[model samples]
Target: MSGKRYRLQKTERLQLKIKLLVAHGSNCWWCEEPFSPDDWPTFEHVNPLSLGGTWSFENLRLTHESCNEMRANHYPISYEVK
Candidate 1:
């Protein structure tokens, strides 16, 4: 296992979470489901940070905690923006 643990600091992570809430509202980027208040959310890197993705808004997504676990280190699917 790669012992390197990659992460954003607490405050920066919180900022990213706030941005995710604004950008995606209650939607889960991986599963496309609305988030319930009880569901904990996580920041998903659309482009895997391990593969050189930046911690920028354009590359981040809001997802349910479980969904993010399922999507680790993978590129997200593309869709035409309407």
Candidate 2:
């Protein structure tokens, strides 16, 4: 298979974000801090996409843009939704 990764559509991202917010609240999954107006919220893959993670909701999370960047593509030892 080609190495190209599938990108989520804008609408699909928005829908997933809404579902994440409802299921896990408006807090950063990595930092556990509430998103501020100035903070950019982003979808994070619990299992890094580089490590073969999928775009499904079960593997996604809402986190601050900074947190996601800091995390990069490192796979965590354990993950639990709060």
Candidate 3:
């Protein structure tokens, strides 16, 4: 991976999008909102690629475009389910 943008081919992008969608559906990772018909889907970086996060399926997630934008590069705080 290079600095700045994490480049991906169209096929790769589509594949990633499909994988994330399957894993998380069309929900917003940050807000837990259901996707709207007019909403666009985007990849939310769990740990933030800018902060040394990998672009792997484990780190990427499906989210509403607006939610991803609002969250920016900030990873959400996780609470233990115990």
What is candidate 2's CA lDDT for residue 58? Answer: 82
User: Scored by Cα lDDT, where does model 1 land?
Assistant: 0.73
Question: What is candidate 1's TM-score against the reference?
Answer: 0.72
Q: Residue by residue across 55-77, what tens digits does model 1's lDDT show?
A: 77777788888887776676666
- Cα deviation in Å at residue 71, candidate 1? 1.8
Candidate 3 Cα errors over 4 Å, as ranges: 1-5, 78-82
All models, RMSD in angstroms:
6.2, 4.8, 4.8
Off-target runs (Cα >4 Å) in candidate 1 are 1-6, 78-82
- Pairs of residues clashing in candidate 1: none
Instruction: List, residue by residue over 1-82, the lDDT tens digit for candidate 2.
Output: 1223488778977877888999999889888999987995898888788899878778888898878887788876553333
lDDT to native, each model: 0.73, 0.80, 0.71
Question: What TM-score, to 2 decimals, does candidate 2 have?
Answer: 0.83
Which candidate comes out best when scored by TM-score?
Answer: 2
